[model samples]
Target: MNLSVGITLAAIMTIACYSYLWRENTLYRIAEHLFVGLGAGYSIAMGWNNVKTNAINPLLNDGQYILIVPLLLGALLFTRFLPGSNKWLARIPMAFLVGTGIALSARAAVLAEFVQQIRATIIPLNSVNNILIVVGTIGVLAYFFFSSKFTEGIPGLKYGALVGRYVMMAAFGAAFGNGVMGRISLLISRLQFIFGSWLGLM
Candidate 1:
């Protein structure tokens, strides 16, 4: 409950979690389950608070009748626990949630991935970097063009496609290296926390 005691407890849990690096054991399993349980409890509490403020308060104080629709749909999700044919009632809410989620995701993806990417690619070909960007963008797009036969169609289509393939591979390799670097940074930070804060061996 005290600051130092809490920090010590956290350090112990961290060590228990890292113990899995050597081999699976009781300590690692206990830490993992504790983490999952705490996460679920926190999520439930946050969701409850959100619904009370956003839905219940608005309906009661602001007289917003429209909020009742979403509340009803959310309640219908629990019908999955009911017996027999009534269990199918859960699908109504589930379908609405899935459909709305897909529509929102698709809209955002189009704006961010397609529209913004194309806008960024339309740079003036003045500098060498700009020319390379243009060429790489075209080559990547050409690689995905399955309609035309790259080998037999245009004069330089085959070579353009080949360039695109290499560009994609280079992009993938860079992304992978960046991900590894980020993970290594996280590992180093954790190690520092254990040595400096927990063990006092900095």
Candidate 2:
């Protein structure tokens, strides 16, 4: 319960993983495999836990007979392990899973990535920031759609697109810098854990 052994094991694993920075070796390979195996095992455990808590417990204790339909669909997933034509039964659950996932994901993505973006850009251009946002959004769109030869003889479109290219480059650069900062922050925290907690070097 005190987790002393867990801390020691994590320290050793961390060193083994970071050893790959110098060169690959047995220690790094072992650490990699251990991490992956633990992740897979944890995922399987969580999957069963979810199924039991949400489906089985309800069906058995609460007498929720309606849960049987989804339970049957879930059970069909294991038919792939059986022999002969029964393997095709797994496809039904797989198709349902894939179709449902895509539908939900696409709906969320349209709201987050498309609708929200357009809504965010619709602010009044009374301020400099708002003006820049409106101009930048239009420029970026023009850069993509107006670069074709059909856009010839269109005055100012080319200039707007050129501005858009720079705007896109700046956006990408900022995103990349943010990602790098996140990685660097993780490294710093890991180092702090190693030196401060593991070595008591504070």
Candidate 3:
């Protein structure tokens, strides 16, 4: 529990994790396995502790039988560790998880994605920025419309598609510029750390 000892251990672990950037070596492999082993042990211990507090003590001592179902489901998750006999028991929780996930996603998709996006697109675009958003949305939608072929009979639609292509190119250019700026910023920050913090020469 000593603060200095904990800090030293943390620094060592950080170095060990970063050592993988170099060539493969025994020290890094040992550190990797040690981390995995410790993580697995910690996860198991915490799962057992949660089950004991929420399930076993409540059911046996405090007269709460309601937790048995979830507790049984949680216990079934461990069946994957058993030999070939009862690994199928884990599928119960897996199926439950997939079902719950699908239900949650279906409920969330209506409000967050579909309704909100439609509401946003239908907002008043009286100002310049909102006008730009409206134009961008329309142009992007027009770009994806495949009713009329771009090269075939329609000239006006082709012009609209050409404008949409320009808008897409401009957006992509801005994104690439921002990405380059981000990398430059990171490089500058790392340089500052090396020169200012390490050498006091910045």
Candidate 4:
């Protein structure tokens, strides 16, 4: 393989991506369309290759007859192209796909997201970091306790709500600062590349 050719293609692709910063025009539109088309074409080609290797060639030579089921289901998915007579045929494959996807997501949700998040929240608050996290969590939770009406007579409840509100406000401010910092860092990196690498000033 030619490394120089690969590098040239990568550089061209990078420039195409960055051209959007100027404005949306024919060049940017063409690049966007090319990206989508290339992605779809590559996906179809890979899927076809997988089916041929795993199903078609094997079934033709020595694989089990059960492999025909998936091929039939795949064919059913294309039935959506037919208007009247064969559209219902697509439902078999569609149903199978939805069923499989839901099953996978259900399995992953409990283990990966739900359980892990709960575990992360249940740590001890002995250290300074843990203590800060615990305090923040309590303050935020207190803010949502609707029983604490902001009345003059109930002093403790009012204070709790105030603490929660301030904590939430601080959290939001910190999040915004972090986001702005990230954008500034990206701008700095791009400038570094243009000035130091491209222009060789550094």
- Model 3 clash pairs are none
lDDT of 3 by residue, 28-124 (tens): 8878999999999999899889889888999999989888898889879889999988999999998998999999999999999999997898878
Which ten contiguous residues of candidate 4 have the minimum total lDDT? 1-10
For candidate 2, the clash count comes to 0
Q: Give TM-scores for every candidate, taking all chains together and pairing residue i with residue i.
A: 0.83, 0.83, 0.62, 0.64
Q: Write the per-residue lDDT of candidate 4 for residues 107-189, one digit (tens) a residue.
A: 99998988986678787878998876766676677667776466754566666677778888898999999999998997687
The local distance difference test score of each candidate is: 0.90, 0.90, 0.80, 0.79
| TM-score winner, 1 or 4 | 1
Question: Lowest summed-lDDT stretch of 10 residues in model 1?
Answer: 1-10
* Clash pairs for candidate 2: none
Q: Higher TM-score: candidate 2 or 3?
A: 2
Ranking by lDDT: 1, 2, 3, 4
> How much does each candidate deviate from the true structure in C-alpha RMSD?
2.9, 3.2, 5.3, 5.2
Candidate 1 residue-wise lDDT, 6-43, digit = tens: 77888889899889999999999999999999999999
Candidate scoring better on lDDT of 1 and 4: 1
Cα shift from native, residue 44, model 1 (Å): 1.6
